[model samples]
Target: MSTYDFAVIGAGISGASVAFELQAEARVVLIEAESQPGYHSTGRSAALYTPNFGPPIVRRVNAVGRAFFEAPPDGFAEAPLLSPRGALTLFKSGNEGELAAFLTNGTERDPIHPIPVAEALRLAPLIRPEMVAAAAFEPGVTDMDVAAIHQGFLRGFRRRGGDIRRAQPVTALRRDGATWRVTAGGEEISVATVVNAAGAWGDAVARLAGARPVGLVPKRRTALVIDGPADLDLHGMPLVEFAGDAPYLKPDGGRVMASLADETPVEPQDIQPDDLDVATLVEWLETHTKTSVRKAPRTWAGLRSFVADANPVVGFDPELTGFFWLIGQGGYGIMMAPTLARIAAALATGGNVPADAAAAGVNAADLSPTRFRF
Candidate 1:
């Protein structure tokens, strides 16, 4: 039986970040079920960073994560992970109340601004003139270099003496005194600590360790790629979003990618696109934009796992002595990865959690897995 100081299950951004952070201090092994790393939702993210995208807590995480994208560590990446890209939120007529609420909620960091109809179209040429009533723009949005960032983490982790094992899914786990005996790839691997960063399969991992589920739910989200005009110049284009997040569009190479923002509850598995979802997204785009998308070039789907309260589950499990919960990141995992990894690493290594995080009400008990028992 091989022994490791820490065994991180899941090689997505969350697990990768955690393994990398713990490499210098512990002998860590990163296990991924897929043939390749990030074969699931991590590689299929929207690939953009917007500070004002989600709720207040998510926004705070994004704010702290922006630092890593702005300046990555040496030898991790050659170029910056963030590129300038704006975002425009569109509101239909007679929905002045939602617009006011959005503006009020987004003006905290001065990143969101109310823009007139003409200005909205000027920023994103795809917006229809008559359909647009009013809009808000945030020039601070940036296109996230997800591939580079993932590679950076992998490179750093491996260089720091961390091992990454792909296609080694943990099938059974049990606590043996102070260590865990994990069975994966027909072998028994023992570890003093286990980090449950298994994304959609978080609950299953916990169950393997005889721990209770944390109510983590995996929701399906679909995306479709439509062909754009042959001579389309997508430069200076902002991510155009409909009010209440009904549907949205973003530039993808020479094509345009659109989504219905559907959140269908699903099990943890390899997800595929729904044809009806693609058709609905195209129809929605036709109603909001002038671009006539008859059919899409490609369509795909992935799961964005979340808990009952929609907050990320970090820190250790109160019930399981050596088990850590780093799941339920939802759609904001990529944007908040840096901060989340740092906090998880700190808690795992018995280091002091940041004062800012504590000030933001990041109590250990609050993120414990037992919170769901009550």
Candidate 2:
């Protein structure tokens, strides 16, 4: 039987990043159910990196990961990982209080300033002039190349002698004394530890290993692409989001990528966009802006799994020996990948959290699986 120091399940961004981080120090094996890596959430992400997004814990991770995106390591990628693209959060009349609250909370750690309606319109002319009463601009937001980031990790892992097994869905897990026996694709492998980075199937994976479930719930979000005028020129526009939990629209290759921002609970599987959700997105777009959606648009959906507190769960399982969890990233997985990967690798290897993570105010205890032990 083949043996490794660690076995990481799932080959999405989360799994790939953690495997890459651990490969240099440990003999690691990455196991994926799909035929290719990043066939799910990672591939269908919005691919945006906003430092001020998500909850407090997520924000801290995002902040820690920013340095890596700004200046990647030598030969990490042929092209830049991030491209400049600002973000604007708009509010309509009678929603000033909500907008103020958003601005206050958003600017606490980042420099998201309030912009006048004219400036917001100048940044994104698609907004209906009469509908927008207030706007907050985050100038540091950028478009992330999701594929490049995932590939970079895979490359580094492969270069460090890490093994990756695709089309091998983990069917069973058995704890045998000091090692774990993992069954996938009718083959078995032994490892000293198992890291569950299965995203939406995190809880299911734990159950298969006879470990307690962490109450992970997957939620589906739909997005669509619409046609834009050839002469419109929206390459320099900021990502536009309506206030009070409304839909958002972003520039996508001269077209518009719109979403109703719907979060419907779902089972873990390959997801498809609902017709009603797409219609809702189009209706919201047409009602809020001068843009017209007269034809059917390209649409898709992805799953974002979350726990009760909406923060990530990382570290060793409280009750199961040699089982580490690196799940519950929610919608901020891409932005938080670097820091979370570092944290997971350190914790799984019995090492302390990175200094940069501590410097960014990341409380290792807060993200540990122990928090959900009770």
Candidate 3:
């Protein structure tokens, strides 16, 4: 059997980033089930980087990752990873309480401030003036070039002698004394450590390794793309989101991408957009904004896996030696990739948490898989 220092399952963004970070210091092999990497969640991301998006722990990771996205390492990418694209969260007249709570919770860490209705309309001309009572703006939000970043990691990993095996779905993982014997696509691989970056299939991978499941629930989120007017210029239009679990619209290449932000729980597998979700998104857009949507040219769905507490599961498994958990990123995987990859590399190589992570107030224990044990 071919042997390596580490075997990372799933060549999605999480696995790619971790493998890229570890390749220089250790012999790393990235295994993917699909014919191509990022066939699922990573490739279907909305590709927005808003610091105030997820839970507090997620926000902390995003904070640390921002520096890297702002200025990637030397020779990491051919073009910039992030470009400024502001975000506006609007509240209807009756939903003022929710708006207040959002501002109260987000203003401290995020660059979120109250914006007048006129200014909010100026930022996004598609919004209906009478529908909005109050709005908050985050000027630091940016449009992330996810493809470029993922490619950068893959290129760097290959350059550093990392091996990537596509079309190999891991079926079994057996412990052989101090190492792991992994069976995938009719091939066996021996590795000193195993990193479960399998995204939606994280629980299954852990089970294969004789490790306990962390209760990862994969939720389906759907998005639809609609055509825009030929003369309409979408430049400088901020991503517009309504208050109180409403639909959001983001500019996409002179078109608009709309979503209801649904988090419907589903089994781990390839997912498709529901007809009702598309209808709901269209209804919301018609009711809250001036944008018209007759039909969607394309609609798709992706799974955002999350544990019970909704924080990412990182660090080594408590009961399994040399088996690491790098799952439960939810919808923030791309935005938090750099910091999470750094943490995974540090833990796998017997090193401390990276100084940048600590400086950004990221406590490894908070993201550890051990928290779910008790």
Best by TM-score: 2
Clashing pairs in 1: none
Those runs of model 3 whose alpha carbons end farther than 4 Å from true positions after fitting are: 97-99, 107-109
- Poorest 10 consecutive residues by lDDT, candidate 3: 102-111
lDDT of 1 by residue, 189-255 (tens): 9999999999999999999999889989999999988776655576668898877657778988767
List the candidates' TM-scores in order: 0.95, 0.97, 0.96
How high is the lDDT of residue 225 in model 3?
80
- Regions of candidate 2 where Cα sits further than 4 Å from its true position: none
- Residue 176 in candidate 1 has what lDDT? 95
Cα deviation of 373, candidate 1, in Å: 2.4
lDDT head-to-head 1 vs 2, winner: 2
User: Deviation in angstroms for 368 in model 1?
Assistant: 2.6
To one decimal, what is the Cα RMSD in angstroms of model 1 from the true structure?
1.6
